[model samples]
Target: MIEYLIGIAFCLSSALTVLILLLPSQYDPATKDKPSVQILVLGDIGRSPRMQYHALSIAKHGGEVVIIGYKESDPHPDVVSNPKITIIPLRPHPAILQTSNKLLFTIYGPLKVLFQIAYLWKCLAYTAPPSRWLLVQNPPSIPTLAVASISCFLRQTRLVIDWHNFGYSILALKLGQNHPLVKLSIWYEKTFCKSTSAHLCVTDAMGLVLKNDFALQAPILPLHDRPASHFHPITNPQERNEFLNGFPETESVRSSLAAGTLRVLVSSTSWTPDEDFSILIDALVQYSELAAAQPELPEILAVITGKGPQKKMYLEKIAALEVAGQLQKVTVRTAWLTVPDYARLLASASLGVSLHTSSSGVDLPMKVVDMFGAGLPVVGWNRFEAWSELVTEGVNGLGFGSATELTERLIELFGDDKKLETLRVGAQKESTRRWDDEWDPIVGKLLGLT
Candidate 1:
């Protein structure tokens, strides 16, 4: 009995040892024979759509991309299906690292060695094994960048920065153009850009900002998300019903519109102080006469999508305006929509709305691309510095100046069915020719699958 027990113990111990050896390791895999490039993607991997897309892009590029992301955002369903993608969660709270950021902010402000300290704290917590190569996807959080920089130094790895959002621009917007923090962020951007192997950006606008604003010579890789393609328009009742759930009272509106009520659909981030949704809302109020006179006149419904930090404030404003009856008139889709679903939803609508005030002129939202893909006519409020050039008035879409002009333009378009059809066709052509055309190549090149 004693001999048998000893034999079993030995077998169990060997099995346990093998299991330990087979566990996942952070060490760079053996790449002596293969062309191995390890990329360490960091920063807002949870929030930034571009970063989310970057995972797919890197995997498609055929590189060994290891993503270090925040644990708060939960699993990205689309990314989970890709086998080549490896996600490492950096847990965010109840830990010294998270608290360390507060300390750094207090000591040095946003740009002080504070980010570096927080990053170091993250490094200590995430210590597992090191890789031979690393790439950072525009480390926005100073601490995260510090951690990434530290990892590269320790591992003797290459650091690649993808600047999707210009940090200085954001700081300038938040703290004023001449704010000290803005200047510091600008300095950091200049310092980092000169050293990185490649600086990836999404638009020529950003490239100009880097070259002119910062004087950097890094190669700019203009990355665009996959554009809308092959979306069948909403024609069936069941399809319309699905869209109605998102649009609120779509069925009644659809019936009324078919009988000659001009139906205009609008969607935006929210009725934020900056968005100028009030401009559109006020326009509708001014055009109440038009709605009444042409009982068959166009009924305008603005669909508000996305929840923000100021959602409650906006909701309160909506209620205070007594536009709750207009709730059916202007629906708010509070839940997040996947990129493809968002595209389809936009396609079902007649128009998409985008407006920016002086404070947010530089924001070229992802929705603009979706609107183009869906071939929906866009009514953009030009506040200067906007990509409003994309919407040429009376060509593919219309550009409005104020609420009064916007209301007049909508009424004009509502009466002209032939013009609407012409614009719709032009919008579709422009969208497919320009925006959606780059998808296969962009995705292909990024994945190295091309």
Candidate 2:
């Protein structure tokens, strides 16, 4: 069945390639004053920050950008208000895909992909302005990579793939690595990815993997994730308090914070399989026990923010732990905050924790970058090789191998104000390095915007 589907996809792609070549050019002579670049994302535009950043950066460098993606949530205000940036929202998948039984996912999944392929092809080839370049996000690489590559080929546009992680590796988390679907996804990614004009990866390790393993011929640049300008420390006590009080969840903890009896710990998650929230839960339980025994240790207000599939499960576990008296000293609160509010929450926090253990060991967590930008020292899962690229052992942040190790690190930092202060200083220094400074030179040159 998989083989049959692959054959059909190949035939359809070949036909589309021929059709696109025969179509009239989309280039408009009137709009030639500035270069046009299309930023393509298969996911929600607002949720996908890196792609939005790309659009913003291109616009900043005198390039007109047409961002094509699902507009599920409101994107950054700057992106919306920018004159050079135009967003073309794709129609969402059928509601039946969401409402259907899990047993029928196999039937629905391919149908959805087919819909996406047709819609995406129309947007890229016909709907959006003719572009000099098309920058696309990976991990929804299935049809996007193939479709974008072919469209770029036919239109003579440079196809630049921004690799976050291997789509196959992520699929393997659900279906084991040896599964037929996973194998097919691997083949699809490798086959289409090689056709891209250039590559921009999140980590150096990822670049190495692409070069050594995938044997990609294109020039691969490791464009590490950096925090945007909005993510900065709120140094003023009054400003921090005002922002904290604005949120109903943080309002209850204000008295404790004012009394100097509580320490705020922030964690951002997508509640995905790659991030093991169990480790955090267990660590919090241990910390609760330690705080109970050691009176000097401050109570913890753990603010975990983000929307995801596993959120309800984790929330239930936290509630159960609290009821069973396993989390007396730790208060685990989950929230879904706007981007600006999230940054402020991180800045106001005493420390940040990251549960992301990368699906592809080469990819780095953007959450850590955001935390560093907000001047909060992070305690991250250090099992992956790419963790070292973003986190230094004792410099800006700490890395933990297990729940016990995370618990120890948490206690050590909260117990000693001097140690935490030193790390915070390092984190603050990291915040000075913004995204535009790095992006403009390398990416600008790649897109010919410079």
Candidate 3:
């Protein structure tokens, strides 16, 4: 149970946490000195590639960055070790380390938010200077907005709220869509979002909802999350060998590589219920049946990487599936890799399959973006506006509505090398094409406060 609590905090690298910036302005002498751009993410700094970009963006603009986040272990310097960036990690609160039980998260989520926000507030009160703009990640532990809004008002700084979907939507996934708490969350988000200086979201789908449904007055900026340029494919054999060596099981499967029968499908998941990995597992079951019928099909391996509370449950289920069968052509492997190793695996894999359907039905999955960055095509499910925006049906990748359809799509993706290769090429071409230009200017405008 203790370990599970720790994993909950570990896997929640993307959610929670925040930053309250004290930017220099005309009112204080601090304005004449160095104007620092501090970033606060209640989650792990290394866990969030988006915030890493934010830090780099600040440094690129000749501003210092101070990140406030929590990590269970030693902080990974790869994200915020920049000379211009500083980190002030908040100690992990007991609430953050709660297990996967929704009841516990429901009870502790607010506590975790309050704990970290208060800790950061105390930390910043003495160490931070008055600043121009303060940005907070949206759907943050509900109370984050009200507290941050108060701080912004007091500091006379423009507050920028980056919406990733209502936090209630995630709660809905854990609880239920119709729960009164979920409905109340929707009301809470709508009420607070209108108080921000400018609202930013990951997709136009969310922006539309904010404007049309929530009736928010703040300017909605759709800033698509992107991977850094370092996230790319590898050509060097030595580097490839070293990365593969990280996984002994994968390294031992050289037979498939030599026989040309091994087709590797890689997926990075947090193993949460929101991801609905059971759909992928079920689809694989159907595919396995087809492979048994067609002996000419190539051998396949599905690699799912990540750690979370659900890992043990799914592993047991997967074990049962494997044993209840004859010799299978496709095998499933689960791995927990570091950030660098995960990126390398993504780059080397033949295909990237994502089971993530945004919990908010509005936020796009970062895993899909990372896959595209690694020049790997993606297959996933999303019925929301994300279908057209992120996965363009037949263009970049395919999205499925059911397990049966997804099975057919996966078979098609893996059946031919040419089809998969074409997607790989398309992904690479898209990666070379930057979406950064669209949103980078908005960051400058928001951060450039008078």
TM-score of every prediction relative to native: 0.73, 0.92, 0.85
Could you tell me the TM-score of candidate 3?
A: 0.85
True-structure lDDT of candidate 3: 0.72
**Model 2 stretches astray by more than 4 angstroms:** 1-24, 28-31, 98-104
Q: 23-95, model 2: which lDDT tens digit per residue?
A: 6365553667767899999998988888889998989888899999999888999999999999999999887
Ranking by TM-score: 2, 3, 1
Ranking by lDDT: 2, 3, 1
Predictions in order: lDDT: 0.57, 0.88, 0.72
Better of 1 and 2 by TM-score: 2
Supply the TM-score for candidate 2.
0.92
Among all windows of 10 consecutive residues in model 3, the one with the lowest summed lDDT is 18-27
lDDT of 1 by residue, 214-265 (tens): 6767566665533434343443546644565555445445565455454556
**lDDT winner:** 2
> For model 1, what is the alpha-carbon lDDT of residue 102?
34
Whole-model lDDT for model 1 versus the true structure? 0.57
Q: How many angstroms is residue 196 displaced in model 1 relative to the true structure, after the best TM-score fit?
A: 0.9
User: Relative to the unseen true structure, what is the C-alpha lDDT of residue 143 in candidate 2, on a scale of 0 to 100?
Assistant: 90
